[model samples]
Target: MDVDTDIDKHFQQLQDQKRMLLMAKSRKGEVPRDRKPPQVAYHQFMMSHMFRAGLAQSNENMIRSAFVPPAYQPCTTPIMKLQPIKINQLQLETHHRGRYIVLKVMTPPMRMTGILALGADANGDIVLLHMYNQEEENVREATDIVDVGMIVLVKEPYYKLTASKDYALRVDHLSDMVRLNEDDTMIPPQWMSRISEIHDSFEPHKAKADASMKKEKWWKAIRDYTAAIELGPPPDRLEIIKRNRALAYLKTKQYDAALADTGWPGFGPQPAEKALFRAAEALYHLRRFSESVAVLETLHATFPDNAQATFNLERAQKRHTEEETGCYDFKALQREAEHICPPHLDHATYIGPIKMKETAYKGRGLFVTKRVKAGDLLLCEKAFALAYVPERDEERSAGNGDITLLINIETEKGFMGGQADLIRIIAQKMYLNPSVAPAFTSLYHGDYGATPITFVDGNPVVDTFLIERTMALNVFGCPNSSLATHKRAMNNESMVDNVYHSCGIWPQASLINHSCTCSARRSFIGDMMVVRATRDLEPGDEVTFWYQIPHFKANMRDKLKGWGFVCDCALCQDAKQTKATVKKERTKLRAALTEKCNSPVPSHKAMERLIDKLEATYAVSPDLVPRLGHWDAQMQVARIYAAKGNMDQAFKSACKVLVFLGFSLDDSKKGFEIKKWGMVLDYLIDAFMFIGSALIELKALASAKKAYQYAKTVYRIVVGEDETFEKTYEDHVF
Candidate 1:
């Protein structure tokens, strides 16, 4: 029953009303007068609070009797009484919505005498009184003078929805003249202050502030803006202010500031072709290629016939492409992403090798349910979704292959900064399953990749609700994930990461949660992961993968909390605990490793013992294991082999550990999977390119050539130079 509690409950009801608005289709279904319900709710909650605060029934009755104005009684019976309130001191006005106000009665013969006034109770019955503020002889004669200082007395209840108390009172026939004393007239300062405050907070004040800079009172005007801003005006008002500020900035020659303020957030009628076109021009002149491209992109979408937007977009794209190059090496890219290519696709369940769905999406391989080995043949997938982002420069690039695979075109296409239509068309093609409710409408770019599509001609129907339940059952970023990032063709900045990493459908593969140390490994059979046991797995163990960028410490992990749902799996559960007990043991091992490396006499025994202890420490809590810890330990072992002059042993350990590391979705490889034979083929291409540099470092070419030839052969097998594959290959390889 506290005022704050009352306010809070009412606020919640208001919020609920707003939320229900989205599902409402008609005006009748709309929330009934926003102000009324909350006000009533607040009043009720306040009463509850009052009762809880120990105001007993008798006490409340007495308070109500004392507080309730006498005129509020529900009755139309006429009564004669001395009018205590003056009308002259009070001014009243009404707002657009229905609410009433009246000045509290303060002195006898209050303002405006000889007025018949009515007051109403909850039932709207009127109370009437007849009185005059002045002498009866003077009141009737001064019909033309409704002076400000005069007092009027009235009897009876009146009901009306209006803010002005004085306006609700009307002068009716009192034939006798009314004599009034100036000392008896009333003027209400409180009523004037209320009107002044409301006016101060109105839109006109905002317009005044916006007009201030032109009048050269910028500082004073901006200071006045605080009140108007606190009581936020409509978007149109803000736009006008922003536009004015932009012009003011332009006059000062602060072009960038002007442009920034003039854009959508500041002064946008964004879809307006002229506004966007001009903004695009400004961005281009400023050489802000990305921003210019964005403006042009919006303009083009709004009015496709606008040649200027099209031209500007092309121009901006060209500039962007030219300026942005060498950020990544394609050969290295293949190596990094090689893990997406499994040795052989496990399609033991292939049903007649489903062909491509549409001619537009050519050579995209079909669904073949066969279990391919790590190095077995999976059907060659082509592009089922194609997007050509025209750029002025030929050097323009994309993060993934141009065409991506999909389980359902409608559901799987990501929402990123490019080619929204590409995603839209695919989403429209999704099968409508009644049971499948949408998990999220916004697509995060990281959620999908060029994963393999299962069906070509036929749509692979999936229960979206099932997917939602799966995501819920599994730990995702938010505990309640109605915002699954994969449902929409595009989302703004919010859903980018999820969509960007989204590859083809590994329906089963997607079930594995992330872990720092994963037992199961994902290798692209063709478009999907042929998930296999990288290490021996016991039955009944939950499969997991590292949800985070591996190799990061606990602090880094903490920083990424909201990126997705909080993981409550075994590994994450272990990570949440303190490592106080294990710290000492880890420190001791590290010291030993350093001491053995630095000593005048190398102690092999000491190093081996230290490594053993480190392993023991790691085994104590599998959940406590940091991703990089194991890989670093492996490297130490490899180093020991290298130092002992065991070249074969050292090389073998290095290759084994590096290969495993390469498969990791960690900071080093950025989440690009690098496992399986076909992946090795892709990796070898990079190995061939980079091995020469390493070969010179190690003074070995024979080993490097062997690695290169091995990669070349796999490429020849998996990526055959068929024209159909080649035609769609460029866009489908990322």
Candidate 2:
């Protein structure tokens, strides 16, 4: 007995240590990851240890003697047969049809994906139902995800083997599930609640609700309002009470609930101006700015001279413009980035002359509708949701700024978790403001096979698991608009390169496909992702950007392969045609030159020779295909030449750097014709700055001013905002 006790104690200590380690990880601005369980056959899951032995019997007994209400025949699925279900494949199998199933609660609800409970049909055949009220997840601290002991009429119940590896019916759409009340006449005598015991005077409850609202007790107000609503007030009084309850919901930030209340039956086809205004308020709070504008417009049509409605209409209009045009006070965004913990900006997203077009290479990609100059703003998008890990000092400075870390509940240890919290945030965003659902679900989701968002009762159902998979592909880690922060980030200062302090989804930017020779560039101003044209683009030109920079000379193809893409851009095409031995020789020379350049006493002649050899290895002309592998070496040599007081050679080398980036030179006149944009490289700014300085020394003022302006243009495009331009280059400003 002593030996057994000692062994158990040792195991317990190890488990405690593991828990501590997981807790430590969570402190680094992330929660422990949850591993999703693989799906299994319904029959197999029913026979598992979970549903076997005493558990199945215990669940069955819960509904054995208890009466259940006759469920509404809203919809029904094909009877899910008992265990040993098999698939008979056809050449073209029928899809899961829209259906519903009525079930009596047979077991206490458990939190699996959302909330799961065993439900039995009249025939005693059982299935698991998972329910979640998606929109209120972020608001109410004590919201019940799913209620137990209720007869639910589930429309279009999605039957699938869940992440828990069990076949279950998942209902997420508000319209999809009809929750039957215990007091309804349809319920059997034993199942129905006693009227006298449960009923409350409507007048008293409503009065209390109004009193609580005045005292600013939002939840108390909501509770009383709900109770009064349950008592079935007169139709005229009910409308006023519901609108009041909606105001309370808005105050508590339960936006979806507020929106639903505004849509209640009493608010019907031609609602009063007050009712319309209330609906507009809910949509505005929900971030459906465009929809809010539409509602306000309707309200204005009815009550044109109403002062309160007029002010709200203008406010909604301004927000709508911000959303459609992406115009914002960037200086404000900069200030917010400095102080805001997660840096979620309140700017509207702007999309320039770009449109999504079908492509041969990547299925679909962004393209220009009209000609755009280099540095012209293309798209500026606000993040739908951001998961940011602030520096510890920043965490404290932001005033106990607790960043919301999403922890997945299913996994035993969330060691490998990355996107769980973000996924949930995005899911909730879609659930509440489903007008943005089409935009979100249209992004690349690979072949994970999650169903499209289903609409029930005009409300969209949210599938968080689908959101998780989609977020994994589209979330971007980037720097803010501050040049100092961006420079420091590049040099491995406070935030590391591998895992940034922030990551988020910028919807419009996600449409861009990758190309080694990129035509556009993307940067961030707080949560706003700004994209600009790197080259002058004509109408119908495809816009492309690098998905990830290829810093390596070798394994570039392998890296592309890993991303499941094959680039046929000018540079990639040139690389494809080049001989392996010749490329190998160039790589060796580039490596040697890099080492020599980094040394204290370097042979300038040998460095020049290596650069000349590397540039020579490119089978295509620099004007045709920009070289990415060795631009740094050439730029470094240009700076060295200028430092050595060789202005002419430095200017030549700087011009060569331009060629390397596929920028066509127009020294024929003076400055530049803003060369054909090839690919975006890190050192282009340095190259232009050096060229401008060298031009000044060479007594070429016209060309020099042009270089300075070009440098400033690149600065705006790369750094994302212009407030820092003069500050960044104060001494060198023209």
Could you give me the TM-score of model 1 versus the true structure? 0.28
Return the lDDT, model 1, position 549: 40
Residue range 536-643, candidate 1, lDDT tens digits: 233344444444444324543563453444545434554556386875666666766777767776654666566567657654333234323344444555556667
lDDT for model 2: 0.63
The prediction achieving the highest lDDT against the true structure is 2
Runs of candidate 1 with Cα error greater than 4 angstroms are 1-415, 418-423, 431-549, 552-616, 621-627, 633-734
**Error at 79, model 1, angstroms:** 62
Compared with the true structure, the alpha-carbon lDDT of candidate 1 equals: 0.35
Full-model lDDT for every candidate:
0.35, 0.63
Q: Count the backbone clashes (under 3 Å) in each candidate.
A: 108, 6
**What lDDT is reached at residue 215 by model 2?**
88
